[model samples]
Target chain A: MTAHASPIGPGPTGPGPTAPPPAPPAVSPLRLVATLGISGALAGLLLVSVHRVTEPVIAAHKQRVLEDAVLEVLAGPTSYRTLYLVDGAFTPDLPAGADPRTLDTVYAGLGDDGARLDGFAIPASKPGFQDKVSLLFGWEPKDGTVRAIRVLESRETPGLGDRIEKDPAFAAGFVGRTTPLVGVKAGRGTGAPSEVDMITGATISSRTVIDAIDTTLARLRPALDAYAAEAAR
Target chain B: MKETTAREDLLRGIWRENPVLVQMLGLCPTLAVTNSVANSLAMGIATAFVLLGSSVLVASVKRLVPGEVRISAYVLIIATFVTVADMALEALAPGIHKALGAFIALIVVNCIILGRQEAFASKRPVGRAALDALGTGAGFVIALVLMGSVREVLGSGSFLGHPLFGAHYEPWVVMILPPGGFLTLGSILIALSWLRRRRAAAAGEARS
Candidate 1:
């Protein structure tokens, strides 16, 4: 049997152009797997390294913003101290009754000498028309009222609900208001002492803030009163 | 005295191929955050930072990325830069960060970043890719500012939060809402098309 008469056709292993292009030297399955694995590992390492570099700076910046928010809500305090609430009482240290997951952080603003109390800035949140309206509200027990309020986070409607932050009159109305705050229409007289004038187009957002302050204060009043008694001692 | 090709590459995005006006790539942010100048500027800067960083990274590592898996690799790289930008913005400028909110996080999915990566960066050198990304970013910012200014001035009678009109100037409430974004963009697109038609007509007249 000559070579041409063989049962099987000739498999041309030569570098001829017509030889099915040599199968383009297909990448081995192992090589493909290794390449993908290395690429993913490198990407992960890069992300981890970046996270490491930025983590501390980000944390520090957030702390600074929070501190600033405390001062802002308190109308610019000289110094501040963070207190934790547990079992209807405020304490310097985290209390045993305080749920680690939902512990309420209360910031005590101190005067220039750091002895006299300026006010307390407490964060609160409530659902608005669109989403949660997170805020920091300042309270002074001496006045039996809220000192000021600063929006910490809000996803209110752009032109309407956001007016809670944008409108000066609406924000100013929050200051010096008593607990159990109420939100009313802009032109409608705040018939009661604890009422806030809602932004013209942002009744829901305004009510969200007022209701949040009222609810948060109702929950914290006992702790604040207890703290006041402890201070008197 | 001029480098024509480089200049063309840089300026092309501004008018000829604006990511917003002409190309219409990143309309999600273009429409969503253009309510006020402040928000639009913040979003633009954040998006630009992500785009520029991702373009450079993708260009540098393009060769290593396998063709079949390149899209995934590019997306991962883009997401990494976007997260870094978002974190940096939140830490450095919390107010603007808050105002920008999820839009900052949404930069990861902005087609402008991914488009640049898939179309230009992966095929070019790092320097060129970065320049292209910068041009595109600047164009995006300009477009955002235009929309923002129109919306803010008309809707709120303010520019950059400062009152631009007198007390008697009644704000057009629609300009600042979602519809206002569409209106402003639509007007801008119409104006652009008109100008283009005029230019084309003039060129045709000259040829005739």
Candidate 2:
């Protein structure tokens, strides 16, 4: 009976040895680290590849959009050249510019032949009702008057402040407007080249654009005049 | 009976478990970008692309990931696709890109895509995962377009930028504002719930 019991016990226990033991309670440090590292590396590789492939395309598209804006403001120039403002002076490249760089960009519109100077498209930015109001406007240096204006970027309110771009009548007021610009209430009579009728609701945003254009034009007028003369000669 | 048919898996997200209306995920962009139809369309397409790509990639690689770092892994994968989508949109459609602005980059944090990766895609085969992603994405698009149409038509008195009302018609100015998003969504939810209740009652009567 004892021998039989022993044989039975051993037979029952034999199957347990063949069955797989439970996995370790925790993942080994090496395996965990390796897994994370591999996942990270794969993700990094994918991002890098996408960035590399799309970088040039994105840059080119941005350049094209800016060019289109310039054309619209400058009344359809055939070509344009970007000049940079560095340390109170203009330069074509950044390497040769001074350390305290303003890096302001001015686009000089060229005529159909691409040789004669047409006008200048200068970008300007200033605080608005909500945020920064940045825009590009064409300058006819001969008359020292703004040809046209297009908002490049703005973060004003949707219905009111956003009227700066949405209201074509308001934007139309900028065409042929002279500098030292001032914004008054809409529907007010336009008696002066410097006076502009602000949007009915968006006084601050309208004022922001008018003031920014005025200040920027005032500062850059001399340099712009000199550049235009040089290009014409 | 526990697992659904492939067709059901493909169709479920469109209505039964919609990412936006039913699941109530990814509302930030829904409210922000649906101010206009064009913006809504662009945002929806961009989101769909990101969702589909991330789901497929995650489904294919689910087994290799350890449970401990799975969330981080999923985020890393999702972020990669978001970056790709952002760059692709910027390159291909600059106007849309400019209109959508940072919301395109914000797609990475959209809970719907990450939720799918964690809950459904990680457990399913790649084919089924993709189908689910597509359904969910289509549902999101439908919801956005619905809201966009309503807002654009009522707020601006236009449909997709075309004037639907005469000059004398005054638009509901509140419809284009942020509060309008909340009001429209609330009304839609109420209407959907009412329809659902009516259907349930009819089904119960039939069973009786």
Whole-model Cα lDDT of every candidate shown, in order: 0.78, 0.80
TM-score of chain B of each: 0.94, 0.94
State the number of backbone clashes in model 1.
Answer: 0
| Model 2, position A14: C-alpha lDDT score | 10
The second chain of candidate 2 has a TM-score of 0.94
DockQ of each: 0.13, 0.22
Shift of residue A174 alpha carbon in model 2, Å = 2.2
Task: Supply candidate 1's per-residue lDDT for B196.
Answer: 85
Residues A16-132, candidate 2: write the lDDT tens digits: 122222334687778778988998898889888988999999998877788899988998787987777765555556655345334677888888898688898999999987679
| Ten contiguous residues with the weakest lDDT in model 2 chain A | A1-10
How well is each residue in B73-92 modelled by candidate 1, as lDDT tens digits?
77777777777787777767
Which lDDT tens digits does candidate 1 get at residues A8-95?
Answer: 2223211112211112245666765776687678767877887888788878887887887888888868688888876567777876
- C-alpha lDDT of residue B31 in model 2: 85
